[model samples]
Target: MDLPRDAQHDAVIVGGGHNGLVAAAYLARAGRSVLLLERLPATGGAAVSTRAFTGVDARLSRYSYLVSLLPRKIVDDLGLRFAVRRRGISSYTPHRDTGLLVDARDTARTREQFARLTGSERDFEAWQRFYAMTAHVARRVFPTLTEPLPTRAELERKVADPAAWEALFERPLGETVEAAFADDTVRGVVLTDALIGTFTHAHDPSLRQNRCFLYHVIGGGTGDWDVPIGGMGAFTDALADAARSAGARIVTGAEVTSIATDGRVAEVAYEDAATGRTHTVAARDVLVNASPHALAGLLGAPRPPRPEGAQLKVNMLLRRLPRLRDRAVDPADAFAGTFHVAEGYRQLQTAYEQAAAGRVPDAPPSEIYCHSLTDPSILSPELAATGAHTLTLFGLHAPARLFAADPEGTKRELLAATLAQLDAVLDEPLADCLATDADGRPCLEAKSPLDLEREVGLPGGHIFHRDLSWPYAQAPDAADAADEAGGPGTDVTQATGRWGVGTGCGNVFLCGAGAVRGGGVSGVPGHNAARAVLEKAR
Candidate 1:
């Protein structure tokens, strides 16, 4: 089914995610006829911050929380009003009597903390060297993510540090971490960043962990993962406002079912989610911000390898901060930033091995950070005065296949194990300090990969859409441009590697996480797709 030719839009975007909204705003600002459709009753996709508890006033970043990779250029170019606040304390990993606290701004304190944790000043110096290397790589590679993919050799040459490249870009992250840091605890602290949402082992031969580590460290070149000022909702809402102000039309609950590009004007057919009525629209180009698997399924093509999400997310609002057993550290400081729990290198390896065999890790490695601790804007005045705060825990190594056998049972078991692990490090039982909403229920909910897939449109619940790819393209001998890597889209005049946003169909472009350089809430895919469109029109 095709809409009337007269109704053709200059561009149509499917999926009203942050990426799609960004595309709409840019295209509309550029004076193109733009329209965006979202299946949900509202936009924002997984980037939204909502009050998940039935009666809590705390607005938590439900799924995709934190701002690490969002390019400042996108925010400045779009004139987005969203503000991201940097955390003072970077991270804390508590073990027996003491903990490893990383202070972002206080270098002297950070050194002192490391010296005590490692019981030697040598590890602290090594820590400085490792971060210096990452800082250098972050500076060089962050800018290139938004640009056209450079050849691997080109990027390596630009990075220039062979040791940095080998540790981050080439070798398994585990081997690199082991070689750089001598202390076991320090090694774990450094390695945690490499395995955030990724489910691979540190020594996985696939180098999947290396790609994941690059993205986490290369945040807008500064490598600072800032917290959104008001919740994630405020940030996405600003994007929506910018799009509307630029004259782009956005329709919620308009589920796009099919996209066909066989004819002159590409056709987008959708059923009104609100009214269950079918309709077709015409577009000169369609920017799909949905998952790649979703796009393939929509096009009736053979699906890509099923993407598997490998983390369990639990969002909880606590009445007060949990007590820490470590007397040297204050509870406030410990929870203020990323609080790493059970994330040691050996612990992570054991969990991965367990989960890989189709069993949920007995003691899951996870990290928790209190968003309200950093930005009180997430809570109302009453809630804040009452000492209520929001805690979001991300449990690692809980892969999709583990939940595939028994999703409900597995989620409960995993959440139980995850929290128990957290409780072990705390001075008191975690549940004892939990908050209750107006409904008299605990202000906590856990989402497994299956839950994310069902609710947030993440295919197979994979957050990065799938395993992340390197920022640069392979050499000529490596790129399979003709077929598997990337094919001609129905309307795309020029087809390039998978790194290019161009779909095999000429008129369709993937502006989702599946697009290379697209991970987290970074708007690189949207920005790149728009630039590609504008370039082609010229």
Candidate 2:
């Protein structure tokens, strides 16, 4: 079948992932003729679920891995029905003699428990003050993620206000934690939030930004942490359904081969892989959900420059539940929320160093989640009866640029080593219940973070479109400071400003993790992109 070529729409969104779908939905809702094209047969990109095991459907990125910094108002405004269940995230660190679990719900009780276990009242108090301060800053600044970058006047105001500036952008998370806690265990627990889904070390100055990053997960006022009821895919499915209902046309298995520009605007050339047919669609605008590097390749151009970090991912399927040493934990607790295997702050720093050197750590710092423990509906009847589960292990970082050297073999070894590490940690004999060969690891898939640079067409797979550094956010003279700081390159503020959905680059705008607020599954970039387009149409 030859691909159908419709008349030019108001926008042609490439990559029908969550963000693309979101941008399309907003455009369609605003009465624009919008079309969404995806290379894969299904939408959602990373935020998807697939039937991997026989009779089992599991989220691709399990647990939506704790909500990204998406805005709540957009959810209500779009009438999106991706049901998110709220629960406080818990962190646990177990040693030979002691273990500690930090619960966001009963902070007072949790604090008491911490104080008892670590014998550090000062640490507990510090944690309280830090959380309160960080949460306050997050409340004020995170909302700006959905809007365009701050104007010069607003930026100046924030920079001039000492209290406002420190609360929002200046306080270093590590320094803050060190000042608050004398116990290593308590300090480790507080720092875990900074490392979740990221490769940053606990001691790095960049970790301060992570403090604000945690606030994004708190859901504005919806409380901290939410699990989409049916799994993360439901969130994407709801957005897709909402987009279609709102009159956006979505075509999957339609790989965008190139974005050819006629010097004035861009037209996307795509190949429908299933039919071996090619087609072209003209648009005044385009939104790419792929990583910046991937997008640059499709455009047949030198990728725009990027920052120096990479994004990598790993997924796992387990035949049995993780046997944790913390006997007090309810068996149900394993699946109810995320589990952090952070031994201490130094341990995390070592892992980051190893990754930087292009080596996997022997005892990796990991954040593990067992979806079967949380959502039983996806498990097979037999698996559920036997308490089998699917576990996702994130936080294995390597030089982002290393994937090109030995992608498959390296990933295979990393996955095998990770499982071995898991075996070492578990009290039970996990090796006995192995369902798949060690050589053919199913869940452990790897992708270079630098690849995001290509896919999203951003500078260094440094998504978030720009780096939300303190200097960028708090500079009194944003335009002048950004200009001086960047010299001739794009910095954070300019990146955030260009993220308006339909307003930037002659209809080509941005949405997704690489936009203004960067990566995570929050859907904020998508939502913001949509609003930008809709506002323009109005």
Candidate 3:
């Protein structure tokens, strides 16, 4: 289990998450000696799919559900045999006895639904105009993510439209949402993107919500979140295959204990769980596919502030899709896309206030989506024939702080309350539709922020590894500007250059969600890190 005494490689990758796998594949394919170390028994990280219930044939996307920010370039570049199917219904939000369903196939019906929900077609018009502007921005900015860092001024100029730039990048997202949409439900739907896994309100001057919103909307240059054909696990599995086929050595259950470098060559020490023996591998470059906080600890440096995640994740196997209280909308259509519950604009604000005050929201704002409805490949033939389905719920404004006092007690209370909120919008209780496990227990599982931190190695369970950041650089001088200007060399003490993956150490780089433009299932940081090293070699 221990690496050879003189083991060495051109690149040593820490953490075998999707990003690490990506870096390995690219580096190895380029003919660089590559070794990737993963602490877990598997390499998917939080993006893996699992059958939570015993004796169940369903494999649910446990933590990260949907894919949006992952670029098509990564898919093609690696020759990954994976595909994503777009949801037919964008979203459905119920209020009282009625709902607003946005059917992608039927814009006329969607327009009609919007009018019924808001009592006017003006909001729909505004929605179209607002998204058109975002689409413009998406087309302009998304391509730059893989390129060298561009300064704020450069990105603004590239954006061209000053009005769009100012509305999205300069001002608070809540202000933009309120100015564009008059209907509370409509406003809430738009604002949910800004709040997903981010613990900030819409109007915060910090603009954290804006960053989240930008990433959500600019994905694939169209902002549509799609379902992976098999499951999230299949996507990462493809990455792993690509890495191995390209000659990257992947070691699972090998916990990286420390990393040391001198701006030239680096030494990585890992403990092989199988042998409980530590081994060291020397490499010309080190890619850290872990959170910044973890990277700091590994490098014996001061760690950043612990990130606080604000959400509750629940996965369930349903005997049958829950019927909606609004009978006019079919259960398949309602659950196929994002099903909003108690997420009206006012309700969202109130929930934020309650959570900020160290209490669970009276009615948690959450969204549910049925992966089975889109792709039944995760289900066995028997389960599929029985009309079984998988439902994943994301409860917002339930911060890590809320579970500090009593993790299990809080999770139990929060899950019940959140489901009750869903029940109010359903014809019957959600429990009525749950498929029992082989152990005769309800097929339900809930993960709080605390649980994510413990299991997934996410600091405070912050899903993005920390707060989401602007894809482009904010500084007046791009980090790599000097390099472009034929500067002497990369700053060894703070090595970040063009790709935003650079660690302070010259030979070390970040290739994970903590890197700029690096959240979600995107392999951008990994690709960028490899590019940086290859460029340096050139």
Candidate 4:
């Protein structure tokens, strides 16, 4: 919907992702005239829910799934109408007839399962202690995500546990995992969080994995990644509704072309994607909810090094949950939470090494989780009664370059390889249980990073926009500090402050995942960006 641009808005937000929607809501709630423009026909960029399988009523969270980053404050402040439930089964990793399973409600069963797999009670004890430390760190650090960032020294003091800080921040995550568990499967399970959308050796001296590891562990005050009730789209829907109710003007199918700031106000030029009619509107300030690269293009700034995404997303509607070869547990138990397939520690390293060298691995280390198992709201009554379920798979180490050479062929080969790996653990072939779509085609679709870039505006298909930045305020090293101290081009991150969302341009700011402490579906970036704008307006 296009609104009359006769009057100027206090702020204009580009893009309609959850972050963009969030920034608009908060800015408007503060009594500012906010106008948000989105390129897509509808809001909710990647956090979308769609009826993936035609002829089926199943609405799968197409891109992003689960909930952990969104804080309770945003939910309560917006009065958003949505619910998230905890998965009963934490995770299941099958190895032949027996597998390692973590039950959220049953510790005794979990311990027994662990003991059976490792043949030792020590590993389970270590597992409990290790997570307990992470839980404490999560409670301490998660609150700061939406607030002003503290310096590294202050955050470490606040954490107060030198060992915990060093283990997570200073050392390689693989070292911590290896030290904590004897079994490779358990170690791999722990390390998976560090490499969600990132591709790097766990021991990379750059600590790229460290930042990724921290974000995953410090979400939702419990570090427990939970399932969204309806789908990821529910969160975006609620966010959009909140923004609209707050008096924010949200214009969809409005693709912004350029932004001109005269160190005072910004003029936003956009084209109506449907009609091809271009419009330019002025705003007192502009909040860019697009990627840093996307914003750079709009401002005609020098582009940074391209970031690459590393994951293969496969959405499937199953006729029935495939039977687990392990007879001790039912399919429901295996498919509930993160169901690890061939994701052992050594196995993960092997895949990473191969993918890093531009070759797809023979066996990919990925995981599957069934949304219907936890919340059946995503599926229709008929589908539910017919034992239909929605399965989302995340394959690691399938970087953008791997598909660059052979997009379709590589995608097909990787998908086949990953499913074949999955078949190795299950009693029956995964393809056999796939439901048919409206056209009678199998209900399964795979996406590579190349595909993600074309569909969604993720440059290089990076999920977090770029590599996740450290949450603290201090400079990592002397070289980075020198860069911030005017050794070269402008350092936008310097103005990003402990909580500031400035993009180095006084009138322009980053309101997307590229912003400090900006990642996930949390809405922290949006909330913090609004806070920055409100503070400046005052």
Best by TM-score: 3
lDDT of 4 by residue, 1-538 (tens): 5555666889999999999998998888889998999998899999999998777899999999988888998889888898789888989999878899899899999999998889988889998999899999999999988787677898898888999999998998878888888898888888888888899977889898889988998888888888898999999999999999999998999999998876477899999988899898999889888888888788776777778998999999999999888888888998998999988989989999999888999899898999998899999898899988999999999999998878999999999999999999989998899999989999998989888888888878888888888877654353233322432255543335436466666677788888878778889889888887787777
TM-score of each: 0.96, 0.82, 0.97, 0.96
Q: Least lDDT summed over 10 consecutive residues: which range in candidate 1? A: 486-495
Per-residue lDDT of model 1, residues 41-159, tens digit only: 99999989888888778899999889999888999999999999999989999988788999998989998998888777888898888889999999998988778788889999989
Q: Is candidate 2 or candidate 3 better by lDDT?
A: 3
- lDDT of each model, Cα atoms only? 0.84, 0.59, 0.89, 0.86
Better of 1 and 3 by TM-score: 3
Clashing pairs in 4: 70-522, 149-498
- Alpha-carbon RMSD of each model: 2.6, 4.8, 2.4, 2.5
In model 3, pairs of residues that clash are none
Candidate 1 wrongly placed segments (more than 4 Å): 1-6, 475-499
> What clash count does candidate 1 reach?
12
Candidate 1 local Cα displacement, residue 304, angstroms: 0.8
- Taking the tens digit of each residue's C-alpha lDDT, what string does model 3 give over 131-227? 9999999999989988998888889999999999999999999999999999999999999999999988989999999999999999898889999
Off by over 4 Å in 4: 1-6, 475-495
In TM-score terms, candidate 1 sits at 0.96
Prediction 4 TM-score vs. true: 0.96
Candidate 2, residues 1-538, lDDT tens digits: the string is: 3434545777788877677877778778888888899877788776677654443444445323456465776678679986666555465566543456666678786777676677766766766776666565556556666666665457446435555455334566666667667776667666666654445665556653454355443455332666556677777889899899999888888888887654235788889888788888887667777655555566565565655443344555666665566565553554455565644667666767877787766656656666655466665566568656666666444545555577667656665665565555566755565445234544434444555444434344343443433212333344333322332233322333333332123344556555545566667667766665565455
